[model samples]
Target: MPDSSTHPTISSAFPLNVLIQGEGFPILCLHGHPGSGRSMSVFTNALSLRFKTLAPDLRGYGRSQTVQNFEMPDHLIDLEALLDRHQIDQCLILGWSLGGILALELALRQLKRVSGLILVATAARPWGNHPPVTWQDNLYTGLASVFNRLNPGWRWNIDTFGQRSLYRYLIQQHTPETYQYLAREAMDAYLQTSRQATQALYKALNQGYNRLADLPKIQCPCLVLAGAGDRHITPASSQETADHLPNAEWRCYPNTAHLFPWEMPNQVLKDICDWIERNPEVISFKKPEVRSRGQ
Candidate 1:
């Protein structure tokens, strides 16, 4: 397993905690909303054996400093600064859920710098041509908040029947041990995430954060992995994203949900490794040089 200890550093004037391990071509792993860098341990630990992995706890999540009010642009700036500070000219990105959306944005902004993209259980445009935020969505968010407040650590507390039921429903296709482990880690990260940050991100998503039209702008190789049983971001949505990309492949895992990476770690690892091996050029792709004002 990759070292769980995260080193704190300043990026874009904001304190961020990042987990860096192994040594090879870089792979940046971005976790989903209400999740920290630790949430990506399953993929990071396995990938670290062959490639350097950098998983950062995004702003207002995990050990990173919290911001009262912010938008998606702030996160983009932070990511760019992180890459600059690390002196990484190019790297592959593995993004899950909300992180996948950010990955697309980063790839668009830094066309050459982002060598490849691995989008898991996410969509370029969440809700897929429908209204961004519906009443059901609002109700779901409200209920989640109320549940979090009413039963602290309920998601991971499997001793009680209620907790176990909720855990099983939210996280499917997991063994008893895997369920316990993932639930605990996910709950811990969720507890640390700032509620304000969650709301801000939700608001941003509601404000028409669609990237279907922008998918063609990202010309790098992309692998879209989706879970057939995913309810949050349906497989259809993921397929749409893959279809729009100029160069992309799609794969759907059966009997898996949004947390499929954790449920089927070995398969996901093999798929990613195989894809990277097939696309050797991702490591050697050169970034376009920026000439000074008087070149």
Candidate 2:
């Protein structure tokens, strides 16, 4: 960890509650659903030696500005505003789960701004459509899907999400302490926020378009991470997406589940560091876009 005595939070930048820490190459970190920028602060801090990290609590989550009507576009707007506030034209992106979806969207819209990608525990399509997952994963996902339609915030409860059936399937690698810490952090993110906006944000992820065809157009080097025991996105989903990216390396850690940043911090850092060291081209100040034939 890189000097963690002080808690860093910024409220004046583009109305976004951001955690700006470290001092090195800029790298934007994105957290998953039902999570806030605080959840990924440890991971970002670990990388502080090699990169300056800026993580924003997306609209309606954490201490960030509450959103009344949230959607995918809203997140994109937030990201652009954040980059503009910093006057960052291009930089590396580290997106976990839902954040990966938005990163992909931003990459397509502004390819010039993406120097590289670090996608973790994400899929090319919606969670429901992922393959090679247990029936238990599918069942809970199905129930959550239907419930989200009627009440998008039904899964916001810590008790409900911590149920043995659902909790066991999401993260298999944990201890009494780690589990408790993660559970509390997860609940705290939604403790104070707009339920309507958060629900809409959760629902919007499922409506994303197919991006498999666009993967090859990414010009920068990429690293796709997966957990062999990931029950949510599934290892197969990550593998499939990695296969499409023209310049990418796929690494799936054994016995790990979702939330690799917390479960396997050292391993995550090592792999990311190694990838960055090997691919200096990804860190170039200006990486040209790769125009597909049709475009």
Candidate 3:
């Protein structure tokens, strides 16, 4: 909502809307489910102090036009197209929740383009090991109900105010009408991509795209950050992801939930910036040579 319209728009396989802030090496940040690139603007604001940040609303979410047959492959292709538009040959990727999974997939498929990877509160088998049935059910039901009402032909106009106004109206404090409007906007997009999204979810669930098995294929330094109290993904899941990546540093925040970035922005920012600073040469960042007994 911060006037994202001020950013550039590019034509790819789909119409792509992106926000680029600051000027330095690129650090692309991806947001979680049912959310847009604007959701991770907190990170962009922080990282923009040092690095150029590219945040795009994934396909089927926010300002990005929905891809009719949405899937992991579609997302990867969209990302590739976006990069091609920008003429960015290589960059770092930071993804949260669902976005993290996509980031990993992109890194796996295009190793040379990715310099480093950062995953937060993301798991390989997210649907298979969800937090609770009730929560998941509630989310899907709410989304489905909302999607049913939108006109499939309506297109979202990319703008900065849309992000700010909507976030304030929904995420901050919302009345019934506010919820209704947000639901309407969301559902309109959802109805268009529901079938493909559902199919992709089913395949991802059944195939078990194990981040663990795919870890060894990653050629960049990786950082895994998890919230200790995240029911959706336990510390053990983070451990499993870290174990898979040969060059991964893992950390768990003791008093955090699944929403670490929202709850403890400054702390998360420090950790990420510190890691990036230390790893000036991508995977070249080294852990301390000595180990502490307390650690």
CA lDDT scores, all candidates in order:
0.77, 0.70, 0.66
Model 2, span 1-295: residue lDDT tens? 0111222233322367889888767888888777788877756878776677888888777777554555556676678779988888888888988778767766766677888989989866645432465777657655543443444334453234333345555556644434444554555664655685567656665455467877777877889998888877878888888898888899999877776666667778889989999998666676457899999
- The better-scoring model by lDDT among 1 and 3 is 1
Q: What is the lDDT, from 0 to 100, of the residue 17 in candidate 3?
A: 77
Clashing pairs in 3: 1-160, 1-163, 1-164, 3-160, 4-160, 147-187
lDDT string for model 3 (1-295, tens) is 0111122233435655788898878888887665676667768988888788899877776677554765556677778788888888788999987788888888877777788999988865453234334554455445434332442211231122222232321222223333344454444434443445556655765676665666687868888998776766566787788888888999888766565666566888999888888888762323435877997
RMSD of 1: 7.5
Q: For this target, which candidate reaches the highest TM-score against the unseen true structure?
A: 1
Clash counts per candidate, in order, are 0, 0, 6
**Would you list the rank order by TM-score, best first?**
1, 2, 3
Error of 3 at 251 (Å): 0.4
**Taking the tens digit of each residue's C-alpha lDDT, what string does model 1 give over 146-244?**
454455434433333423343343446645545544555677787898976787788887787777987888888899998887777888999999999
Error of 1 at 270 (Å): 0.7
Where is model 2 more than 4 Å wrong at Cα? 1-14, 128-165, 180-184, 205-208, 287-295
Give residue 22's error in model 3 in angstroms.
1.0
Arrange candidates by lDDT, descending: 1, 2, 3
* Cα TM-score per model: 0.81, 0.77, 0.70
